[model samples]
Target chain A: MASAIINGMPVEITPGETILEAAKKLSVKIPVLCKHPDLDATAACGICVVKIKATGRTLRACCTPIDSGMDIVTEDAELVQVRREVLELIMSKHPNECVTCARNQNCELQTLCADFDIRHMELPSLVPDIAKDTSNGTIELDPRKCVTCGRCVQVCQEKQNVWALSFLDRGIDTRIAPAGDISMAESPCVSCGQCSAHCPTGAIVECDETQKVWDKLIDPDVVCVAQIAPAVRVALGEAFGFAPGTNVTGKIYASFRRMGFKAVFDTNYGADVTIMEEGTEFVERFAHGKGALPLITSCCPAWVDFMEKYHNDMIPHFSSCKSPHEMVGALTKTYWAEREKIDPKKIFVLSVMPCTAKKWEVRRSADMSSSGYQDVDVSITTRELARMIKQAGIDFATIPEAQPDHLLGAYTGAGTIFGATGGVMEAAIRSALFLITGKNAANPNFEFTRGLKGIKTGSMQVAGKEVRIAVAHGLGNVETVLDEIRKAKAEGKEPPWHFVEVMACPGGCVGGGGQPYGVTDELRLKRAKGLYQEDGATLWRCSHDNPYVQQLYKEYLGKPLSEKSHHLLHTHYVQRPTYRR
Target chain B: MTTATTPNVQEDLQRIAKKWKDKPGSLIMVLHEVQERLGCVPRNVCLELAKLIDVPVARIYEVVTFYNYFKTEAPGKHILSVCTGTACHLKGASKVLESLSKELGIKEGESSADKEFHLQSVRCVGCCGMAPVVMVNGAIHGKLKPESSGKEIVAQYRGK
Candidate 1:
């Protein structure tokens, strides 16, 4: 450990910890423009420069590792002047249309400028004239407002392993663009929306589809049906003054009702249905040897798109079961429509997902309309839902808590945990054991299948057979697991895993690309802990124990893989080229 | 698709990949070899190279756009580069570039409409003594009237 005297305060620094991190311990905010807590410091902005008394030189605090005997002054008149100049320069390049920008109040750059008390720009504006690229439909790239922070590009290329974005050209012309200047729709983008999640400026953001939902809600004949995803409950409270991990499921249901929805359902109930179908499929494969071993979960649409684009060879291993939201959407249009005596065409299902890819997933294929209409009419993000709640003038805190609609709303612990990484594997194992042995495991919580480890692998005793399983999140970590599976298969060896679960974003749905901004590892864990707490509190810990899910299978769909279940609850995949052209 | 004139572009790229595919910092090396043969790198060829090298197409484009040596679009029948080094700039290189652009009816770093002349400004050509040099198809014309030489040299190529 390196000890340093930072800003007249003694601090202990661990190895590889930067000066910025060291300052953070002492409650000293070393202002950074391009530095994110989750990413390595690119040192592109040059705003976090701090003076070293010993060397008599300023170093970028974000990248400079603290050394012993270093006397660092993070704040001084001179340092403030330098940082002010840097901010002014950055603002000069940034567009002057902050009033019209989506990130007007929530932007990091705007916050930094406020901290520095920057009054007016000394330098002239030199913002680019590039047109906004809404080609991706799920995300927008407003190049004119870009400060060239490289956060979005780093997250896309390194964190997600989808190299659809790049810092094209150099010097004054340097800007983020989909590779080869091709539209993001044609590029190898999975529509995870992580770029928007990490972007500090208005350069990248989730495509605002709130207007479309509002229009549908105002339609005279259209019935606005809403479903909230498992991850949304634990995160949507952040828009209000609630803490990060607060469970506002009841509050969110009430808010949706207050905002004008005919019925408010929970996506967790859909997740239970997914577990029923996915667990049955796993049992058939493991016990009766029906289909492919190592059945990969397809609930995360971003991961599904990634698998199809980058690793289509694993198509046989991918579970054909539709994601929970789509399952709920399809069922809402069919069974719910038939039972409610409403016209299926007039019923509009809008899912409030913790994902942006669900926007694209709604229109993926004809199978999405197995209920004779589009399964999901529209998919809004958790962030967008929060905006709509406020726009509807609903006092979230004052609203009385209410329960979700019974027919498609009841969920067990197994379904709720789907928001966390390794959650699907844990939830599936909980019910799969019962499907195979007719008994639930004593301990529903699988400690090995938790946390932010890139790839998790383990084996469990199932009906006297050792079933190997693996869980992977953050698209970059999946290649390692898939390569291992490929190596085993190529040599005709026993499959290394009998089951696999994948989520494209870092911390499953809880840390999705469409969640709140300023997300870090600590926040991810906190948000995931909220889901786990919900899981712990619920009486029914296994998906098989969810009575409402069982009733649905018995009444509407005959069984998990029955003809009607396959028709409305499963989907297919196609090997798509990385470049559409 | 690769241009028809370079029918063996695929095999040539495969050969380059064989030489540098597994090596680190080999993107620029492979690109140099491709540029040596093709005069300019096409987007489709880079997309193909991305697969052969097991790198993303965006990465190839990042490197290709960075360096001034590699051209993405096909160059004209005649390539013209005006030296803009410190020595050349002091010797009126801007005037030389201006006259060339006027005669060619295209800006710097762009090709003419007829695709007969490609003009670009270069940092240095390693001949500071030949200040304000204009390279026409690799034949350097130096130490002349900046205005006349730029127009006169391209006129020579046009007449031929």
Candidate 2:
């Protein structure tokens, strides 16, 4: 190893290490777009140019190696000017639409521009006439705004392992698009929204539903009741400048009130209902040998969609219960409306989701209301709701902490954990234990399924039978788990798990596509902490103990799988075309 | 055409259901197999599968519509999957896509009027070193240049 003295710091470097790598070893930050750690260094950005002590020439630090005695100045005036010029050149061809663009506040390029104070473009703007792509269900792409950073491409190919987006054409005609310019819906996008998440500009964004939600709010006939998912509370705060794990449940309720919503409800209530129906369904399946073994969860729309299209062979394994948000919407019209003597036709259900799939979830004809209205009239992302709150000039942090409206707003800690990957399974165990053993669980925390593990499996004896369960989040993880199960079945071994929970996002609902921007491993765990804390703080931690749910079963619904419950709370799955274009 | 009776769809679903009756999540697996065989996921198949699985039919329908990949209608003869991964972006995959769309005279995700070609974009195919990759009927083609004068990719598929 060779040692170098740069910027008054002694840094040890490998034989042929670059000045940039040595600088990084000394805890120095060198900003360069074209100098990704994984990608081969092109040094085209020129932002990482550094001044050498002895040599008058400014060298591209990313590509240049550090000699043992080399002394480098990364923040000299000449280097600063060179970096500024480089950024300006990059900005010349970039769209100046950050003010009103979808990625306006959340863009990395815009942030860099602000940081460098490069307000005006000295060079001529190359405004290409490119049509925007609204063909995708989850994200829209604006070609004119693309800087061709290839971050979306890198993430799609390297991170998500889904190589759907790519750049095409020569020079001025170059634009990012799917191979063969296919509609994203027809593409194998999987609606992960990672492309939009990684995009440095407004080139990509989750489909905008802000105006539609506002329009519904103004319609007097539409008594809009908003339901916020468990994950939304943890991540929604990030859009409003709150810390990642900050619990914004109270703030969300207050903001919805300010937004003119008739009632603020919790999707966890619906989650609780899902647990009841899904748990009972699982029990029935196990007892009667009715449905598939090792029933998989159906709450994640993305997972459901994936199974329907690519893995329809696994449909019987999916539980027949609707997602928590849809369940809440369905019950709001049926169970809640009947209780309040409100017309189901007048009520509008809005879900504040952390998922793009929720948009598709609400559109299913099978999830329609018996009252002839869409069960969930609108689905808005956590980001969208944050925009609305900001647009209204409401101080989210200062808003009076308010509790959700009665009954539907009330949820147990188990329900709150439904936001994380293993939350659904943990919540189910709490209730399932009570259902089976007729007592409080010996261990309230099913710690086996908790944390950031990609896939977790646990088995517990209930009524002398080992009830095995597996929890998986993210589509990639789901594929691995399914593959394992397939292999097991091929070996003639009984499936290891009786119930499984799958969330499409990496960390479950907390990391949903529609969640607040800039999600990291630390942020997901923080959000998960908030969820578990909320679960621990709640009195009724078990689904079976939820009084409102108990009342619904006793009064309106009769039982979990009763004929009325089946028509309303419980739903079905459909096999989709395997070979989609 | 078969009548829209529940039993009819059940019979269609049973054809596949009988194959995976004992497997875990057999209903979903059978549905996938049937969809693979049928080109489109028919409502009758879903209904029959739901009944066989003993879950509510609504749940089955919900899963079908919730995902973007699931198609409720029949597909065309040839499936064209364009690669949109990062390496392809650097190699100008978008222009290749545009050229294909123009050559095919149809938008992405659309079947040709003749019902011969169905175009779609897929996430990464794990072939970053080879930028601008396209998978037509599962055959991977790399380093594609979308030239106006070039022989249209769809024409070759039509001849096939």
Candidate 3:
């Protein structure tokens, strides 16, 4: 332990803790721009500079480790002056397009400027006219607005291990770009949006599709139907006054109605349908000795894209089921459209997702067009949906609670928990056991496969046969789990797992790229807790128990892997080139 | 002086990697060796080095771009460097650079059409007394005026 006096207040801290972090423990507020709770301090922005009374030197509080017996003054007259000068210098190079920027109200730079009471423009502004890149159609990269904080670069390379973003040149000419100066589409970007998630400014953000949705909503010819993802329900409340994990699914349904959507559905319904398909496939592989062993979930589109590019060998193991939102989209276009006597072509299916990858996934292949038109017309992120709610002047917090449309709306507790890490695996296990033994899972919770661990392993006994399961979230963490299986396969040894579930974003979809910004583990846990609570409070706790799902199988789709289900619910993947050129 | 094929570049990068094998923070040193042999570190060479050294290509590019010493383009046969330091600048080094550029018909930092010479501006060469210094291939010429003397130096190099 290291003891220090911060502003004449003695504080104890652990070794290797940064002074900024120590000060945070002591409730000291040190302003920082480049430092983020989710990333390591780059010290790129020098605003968090502090003076040491004994040494008479100013050090960056974000990166500098505190030493014992250190006398530190975080805020003094000279420190404030230097910090202000640093901010002015940063602002000089940054574009003053805040009013027109996407992050107009929520930008960290704007917040800091307000806190410091910056009034005058002391330095000559030099905003370089770097072109905006909208190549991927999922996220936009405006290099002109970039502050070069290195947070996006850090998240891309270190945390996500994507290596899609990097500093291209030196010093003042330094700009964040794809590593080899290629477009984002050409790079190995999975369109995960973690870069946008970690960015402090409006330099990187989701491609706004709210205007298109609004256009469709106001059109007399268009019958707009919306579906909210499991993760969206848990995290959308953060945009309002509610806490991070507060489940406002009911309020969201009401909001969609006010926003002019004809009907609102829940992606949890699709999640239940996915378990039916994936669980059956797992049983066939494990019990019937058909298909590949260790079936991997294919719900997360970013993970699917990552597999198609980096780990193509794992393609056979990937479950052919479409993601939950896509499933709901297909059902809405075909099943719901037919039931309501509406034209499938005229039905505009919109998906509200907690993922940027979903925006790309909508137009990925013909399978998304299985209903004769695109299964989903527009996929808006949870953040985009929040903006739409605000734009419509709907008080989200006080909105009356309403239920989703009855056709594809009813879901189970297993579906609600799909927002969290290890959730899909747990949901799959609950149904896979029922498929094998012809009975409901003894313990529907599947308690072993839950939490924020990067990779989790557990075992379940189905029909007196042991089934090994592994769950991994975060693209970087997927490598270790994959390498282990590859090594075992090469050595002709027993496989490490019989089933695997992977979510590309850290902490699953709750900590997704398009979730509320400024996410931390605490927020991920709270959001995950909200889902689990919804699961516990629900009448039906198993996917197989969803009456609507059973009705779908009985009325439209014959069975889990029937030809109709395979045509509409399943999709194929091809090995993709990492670079477009 | 030479362009390396795919196999040759891989082999050369492998040799460089062997020298820095099991060494921590040796990517920059390996990259230096690659630039020394090939005149510049090309994209393929960087990819090869990243594979051999078990580092990401993005990280290699980060290190390469951070240092101005590392060149990404092949340099010319005879490099002409004019000192642009404070002392040299005060002594009309900019005018000397201008005259040299006009005489050679090539802008600063560009190679001549014949691929013989490349003009560049640099900081001090550690001799303030010899302000307005020009170095051609490490042979320093001091105290040369921008007018005729700088043009004569370019003409001399052209004839070589």
Candidate 4:
């Protein structure tokens, strides 16, 4: 441990801890724009400059590690002046469209401007005249508003490893754009929206579909049904001044009714059905040795797009199950419509997902049209839903807790934990172990695959046989595990693991690209805890134990992996080029 | 599809990238060789170089666009560069450029109707003492008047 005096207060810093981290620990605030706790500091924004007492030299606290006997002044008159100059320069390039931008008042740069008492710019504003790129319907990129902070670039390149967004030009002309100068849709962008999630400005953000949703909601002929994803409940509270990871599921359900959602459904119930199908599929592959080994999960749409583009060789090994919301969407238009005697055409299934990729996933393949109509008519992000609630003048905080509607609304603990990373694998293992052993899992928790680790491995006894499993989240960490498996398969060796799960976002859907903004590892852990806490508090801890899921199979769907189930619940993959031709 | 007929350009890019395979931070050098061979760094060529060098196309474009020497589009058969530096600006460089544009019927940074002559404004060519300098295809014409001298020089390179 190294000792440092930040603003004359002595503090012990751990090895490799940055001065910013030390100052944060000491409660000495060092303002920063580009340094996010979840990503590596790029030192793009120069707002966190600190002065050294001995050398009188200045350094960026974000990228500089604290020395043993260092005396760092976080803020001083000179440093404040320099910081203001930096802010002024950044403001000169960035458009002053805060009142009109989607992230108005919530923007970091706007907040800093207010904090620094910067009402007028002494320097002339030189906002770039670059046209907005709205090529992808999931996200919008307005280069005019960008401050060149490099947060979105780092998130898109290093954190996600998508290689879609990059610094195209250099110096004054430098701007964030897709590789090869292609449109975002034409690029290998999976529409994860992590770039927007990490952006300090409103330069990158989710494409607003709330107006369309509003039109649909107001239409008297339309039966607008809503399904909330497992992750949305835990993170949506952040927009309404609630703490991160606060579970607002019940209030959200009530608000959906207030917002004119004809019927409220839970995607977790669809997640339960997914476990029934995916667990059965895994059993057929791993336990019975009837199909390919190392069956990968396909719940996360971003991972699905990434696999289709980069890892198409793993197509045969992918589980054919649609995402949880898609499954609910399919059921909402088919089973629910048939039972309620509502016309499937009039029933527009709207899914409130904690993913931007789901916006693309809804229209990605034909299986999403399994209900003789579009399964999911529209997919909105958690942030968008929060905005809609506020726009509707609904008091979200004190809203009464209400229950989701009907048979499709019920879910198990396995369904609730689908929000976190390794959740799908754990949910699958919970049911898969039971299917093979014909008894409850010795431990339904499946603690081995839990937490915020990028990649996790575990071995479990299924029917007295050891089954190897691996869970990988954050697309960058997936390549190593997959390459190892590919190498083993190429050398004619046994498959490394029986089952593998992947979620494209860092901490799965809880840290989803469309979740609340300003997400950090601390928030990720709390969100995961919220889901796990829900799982622990529930009565039915396993998918197979959900009584409603069993009734659905017995009455409507017949059985897991049945021909009818495959028709509505399963889909195929198409090998896509990395770059649009 | 034009690249299909020009196999040598692709081969040259592959060879250039291979030569710098062992050297890190040599993307700029590799790109320089590509620009020298192709006259300009084409978008399609950028994609090819990205694969050959195992670097992202964006990274290559970032460096390529940074230096004004590397152009993204094809240039003309003969180049007409006007120095617009402080020394040349004071010496009627803007009037000289006007005459050149009127002679070629093309604006600055544009190619002629026949694609034989291209015009661009550049910084000092180390001949600032001469002032109002203009270079065409590596032949310097210093202290030329804007009247008919600049137009005559441009017309000389029109057919060549």
Against the true structure, whose TM-score is highest? 1
Report the lDDT tens digits of candidate 1 across residue range A1-581. 55889988899988888899889999998888898887999999999999987676999999999998789999889999999999999999888777888888889999999999988988988888898999878988999888898999999999999999999999988999987778889889999999999999889888889999889889889998999998898999998978998999999989878878999888999999999999999998889999888899999999999999999999999899999999999999988999999999999899999899999999999989999999998998999988899899999988889998989999999999999999999999999999999998989989889999988889988878999999999999999999999999999998999999999999899999899888999999999999999999998999989999988988899889999999999999999888886
Q: DockQ rank, highest first? A: 1, 4, 3, 2
Residue A386 shift from truth in candidate 1, angstroms: 1.1
Candidate 2 docks with a DockQ of 0.03
RMSD of 1: 1.7
DockQ for all candidate structures vs. native: 0.67, 0.03, 0.40, 0.51
| C-alpha local distance difference test of each model | 0.90, 0.77, 0.89, 0.89
Which candidate's DockQ is highest? 1
TM-score of chain A of each: 0.99, 0.89, 0.99, 0.98
True contacts kept of 3: 0.53
Off by over 4 Å in 1: B1-7, B124-132, B143-150
Spell out the clash pairs found in candidate 1: none
Encode model 2's per-residue lDDT on A1-581: one tens digit a residue. Answer: 67887777888877878998888877888776555553445565677888877786788888898888788887767776777887898788787877789887787677767777897788998778877878755678887888776766665555444445655544555667664445566555666676665565688888888888888889988788999999999888887677788888998898889889988889999999899988888877775677878898988887777777667778778888888998889888877787788898889888988888787778765555644578898888888888899888899878998889867888888889999989999988887777666887866899988887878988988888888889987666677788877888889898878888888777888877778777767788999998998888888888888898887788888888888878877666777643133
CA RMSD per model (angstroms): 1.7, 12.2, 2.6, 2.0
Assess the local accuracy of residue B7 in candidate 1 as a C-alpha lDDT between 0 and 100.
Answer: 52
Candidate 4 per-residue C-alpha lDDT over A1-581 given as tens digits, one digit per residue, 9 for 90 to 100: 56989999999989999999999888888999888887788898899999998787999999999989999998889998899988999999988888999999789999999998888878987888999999989999999988888888887778788888888777888889886567888888999889988888899999888888999999999999999999999999999888888899999999999989999999999999999999999989986787888999999999999999989999989999999999999998888899999999999888999889999999988888999899999999999999999999999999999999958999999999999998899899889878887888666788989988888998966667889999999998999989989999999998889899999998999989899888888899999999999999999999999998998899899999999999999999999977783
- Candidate 1 scores an fnat of 0.83
